[model samples]
Target: MRPAAPEDEPALDAFFGHVDAEDLRFRFLSAVRKVDHDQLKAMVTIDHDRTEHFLAFDPASGQIIATAMLAADQSFRRAEVAIAVHRDFKRMGISWTLLDHVAEFARWKGILTLESIESRDNHDAIDLERERGWIASACPGDPTSTILRMTL
Candidate 1:
């Protein structure tokens, strides 16, 4: 895994192509048909102090198979993380690994809290977050979603 660089936009965009529709919705928290160039640009071009986007590659094919993003608040005391993996790479423990990696990175950077906003319908992700020790609560004013939070 490595931090996403500006030149990695192409690869990141292509990586999202393999993310199934439902996963895209879970990642973006909306029904996006395709991840736009602007979003890809934002992912690659971020301030290191406040945000991080990581790319995971397939060792054999050298293709990007997953991405994990962490964005912090103004004070850097808390951050929200989101992850997405290519459909072909599911069940390989990539998400679990990335979540742990990102949490460690966040802790190293002095972030005290980590959280993720997830759709209630995304059972696998919600379960994984809970299994990883994140506490889930109903998202205020949005009953369709759940918020997973952990104090690091």
Candidate 2:
């Protein structure tokens, strides 16, 4: 795992495209209305140029299999983490590695907390977040969505 660079955009897109549209919806629900190239770019690289993007690559192929974006708010004391892994790479410990590094980055930066909101229907994701000690909250009238937070 490493910080993403400007040159990593194409690989990032490719990795994202490996997951089906329905998978994306299941993970984010209506919170993410669409997943277009511009949206992917913005989520993966357009924020902080240096340290916010974390990627997992296969050393044998030099191909990124997963990515997590940790973008700090204006205060720089907390961040929102968004993670995505290629469908083929799911359950291979890539998300765990990415999330672990994201926590390490937050610790290094003296951040207070890391937050991730996943759809309630995305049980795998919810379970992952909960296993990491994230506090979960539900969206009113929406049983399919949840907000999770972890103190750094």
Candidate 3:
């Protein structure tokens, strides 16, 4: 796994397609946006001027299977981490790998806390955050979404 690149845009879109539609909606907060190739790239593509994006690939097959983003807010000393695993690799630990990578990056980057904006319906994601000791609370700016935070 490594930082995402411009050339991996297509793979990123394909992998997003591999995840269940409901999972995508849960992560993104809307089922209406199809997340076209351009949008997917913008979502996970690296931009040092802005956010950091990570991609995981199969060692043998060289296939990108999971992706995550850690976007830091300069004024807050906090970062938002988002991750997705291809449905084909759902039970294979890819999501955990992505989370671990993001967590490490957050620590290395001097981020005091990491937050995950999850929908109330996304039990799996909420459970994962709970398992990792993230505190769940109502989103400060948006009441509809639940925010999970963890100290680095």
Ranking by TM-score: 1, 3, 2
Q: Per-residue lDDT for 39-63 in model 1, tens only?
A: 9999999999999999999999999
> Judged by lDDT against the true structure, how good is candidate 2?
0.76
How many residue pairs clash per model? Answer: 0, 1, 0
- Please write out the lDDT profile of model 2 over residues 14-103, one tens digit for every residue: 776776676667644554544667765665556552338777888988888877878887777778887888778889888777888899
TM-score of each: 0.99, 0.84, 0.90
Compared to the true structure, candidate 2 yields what TM-score? 0.84
Of candidate 3, the 10-residue stretch with the lowest lDDT total is 41-50
Candidate 3 lands at a TM-score of 0.90
Error of 1 at 81 (Å): 0.4
- List clashing residue pairs in candidate 3: none
User: In model 2, where do residues sit more than 4 Å from their true spots?
Assistant: 26-35, 43-51, 140-143
Name the candidate that leads on lDDT.
1
